[model samples]
Target: MHKEITIFNETILPGESKTIHMQIAKLHTMTDLQIPIIVERSKLDGPTVLFSAGLHGDEINGTEIVRQLIVQKINKPKRGTIICMPIINIFGFVNQTREFPDGRDLNRVFPGSKTGSLASRFAHYILQEIIPHVDYAIDFHAGGAQRFNAPQIRIVPNNQELKKLSDVFGAPFTLYSNHISGSFRTSCDHMGTKMLLFEGGKSLDMNQKVTDEAIEGSKRFLKHLKMLATKHQSMEAHATIYITKSDWIRANFSGMFHGLKAIGTFVKKGELLATISDPFGKIEHKVKAPHDGYLINVNDAPIVYQGDAIFHISKELE
Candidate 1:
């Protein structure tokens, strides 16, 4: 027999999925909202998987990916559930900004308080109402609008269970990063829930390659966990490099940029990465890598200023 679970004032039902818009605050004639959501759950009982995106509203690729996943008519899980919340910060999404209307970063205010700030209250609600019920979670993201990241999974290296899940996600790259305080991942880890962060592309834009990778990787995750039937022909493995540490290459002087390298390229120390030139085409400044690593992210546009970040290099550990 299958049992359905409902949450948040019965607005979300397990067997049926829909968007639950919760009013967070009202500004005279305007009202701010947060979207509490639940996707259709499988009829059988098994592990529950949560897919969330748009914690930073402008990072929209993940939102689209989750939307596509929920609509996909795959064979029902033999024993499990899938809950997807494609957009969490409706305020930010409406404004096309990364932070909330209160200027708080929703991603940084996790496991929040019941009577705290708006962000904190939302966090508290998610922690109390949702996190307790999930066996695992996948939080999707992309680089901010001004930057682009190569498709990758971010997981903690020491956590063997999470590492296995990251590998099973099957992205082209993985980053072993420690959880920071007040982050959703850290809060989930404290609650003993393993969460994987999927990052790619740029904010507010859809890259077909990134979208395809996310869809394929998520299906692979479902198969690995036995939440979906495994297809023999859909088992091709992709190469993934593990990097334990990554750093940004910043502009040394203010000028227009002429990039010579692309994202996902391996670079050695002292490699010419870009050239900075003045408006008159005089006094060209050469930008080079300070160390050897893979360029997993780089600024795509040519215009830049002093101290602007141009490249993100990840040094492989395993």
Candidate 2:
């Protein structure tokens, strides 16, 4: 049943849309920074779904996806609430950095404390304020700096409902990732919240393909949740595989890396995925696949240090 949702000490009634400005912390110059949340509730009873992005401030695909939702006004929740927090790390977002200004990853300090660092304090506040009111959540993510991730969903394994949503979201692949310490997924899981983490594109710049997929997949998900009053466009039916086990292909030598394939390409076992060569280009080292799987991520930067995870592969079932 749909219920009254509250965030940042403000109550949003049914069939209402409110932007709650949450002041998380004071800057070094004593200026206040706020996390703006957009809450849209429906006239009928349904599940409250939360869509968040920019936990790593540099990932702009999710931020752009939310912006488009607001621009198009497509998020008319017919029965439940839709909470949109596009940019969570305002400090890092403004600074064009992934972590907080204090150099701690915002995603690593979830279920945090009030007296902790800037990131932790913000995490604690948002986790306490917004997550409790949410019945389902989808946190958007992407590859770290100098890397790119194929569009995929990372879910906690053995959860059928979550698995069905992951499939309905229509990503080509799904990853069964473990919960990391202090992560947002971990915190939500502890609170018994069902959530999915979508990773696509790369850091900084927003790729059009990834962004389009995100928007389409999100609309499909909302439709599946019965939030939308009408049916969404029919996305092409494609087999979605689960990449249960994955590993990163580290650079064998300190040199320039030349990728053989981009995201979404399936490589065979022992296939040449990339080549690492010295600056002079006289000597080279090959980075090949140890198993047949789709390439999820590849280092974008040319120069890589030894043992850098430039390529990622996961074993999948067709």
On the 0 to 100 scale, the lDDT of residue 13 in model 1 is: 39
Q: Candidate 2 regions off by >4 Å?
A: 231-237, 316-318
State the lDDT of candidate 2 residue by residue for 152-261, as single tens digits.
99998888998898988888788998899989999998987899899998889898888788787888888888886563453653557788888898887998888889
Evaluated at residue 105, the lDDT of candidate 2 is: 95
Clashing pairs in 1: none
Tens digits of per-residue lDDT for model 1, 69-171:
7666432444576778888877778888998777888889988889988778878888887777778899999998568999999997788888788778888
Give the Cα error of residue 220 in candidate 2, in Å: 1.1
Q: What TM-score fits each model?
A: 0.91, 0.95
Q: Estimate the TM-score for candidate 1.
A: 0.91
Q: What TM-score would candidate 2 get against the native?
A: 0.95
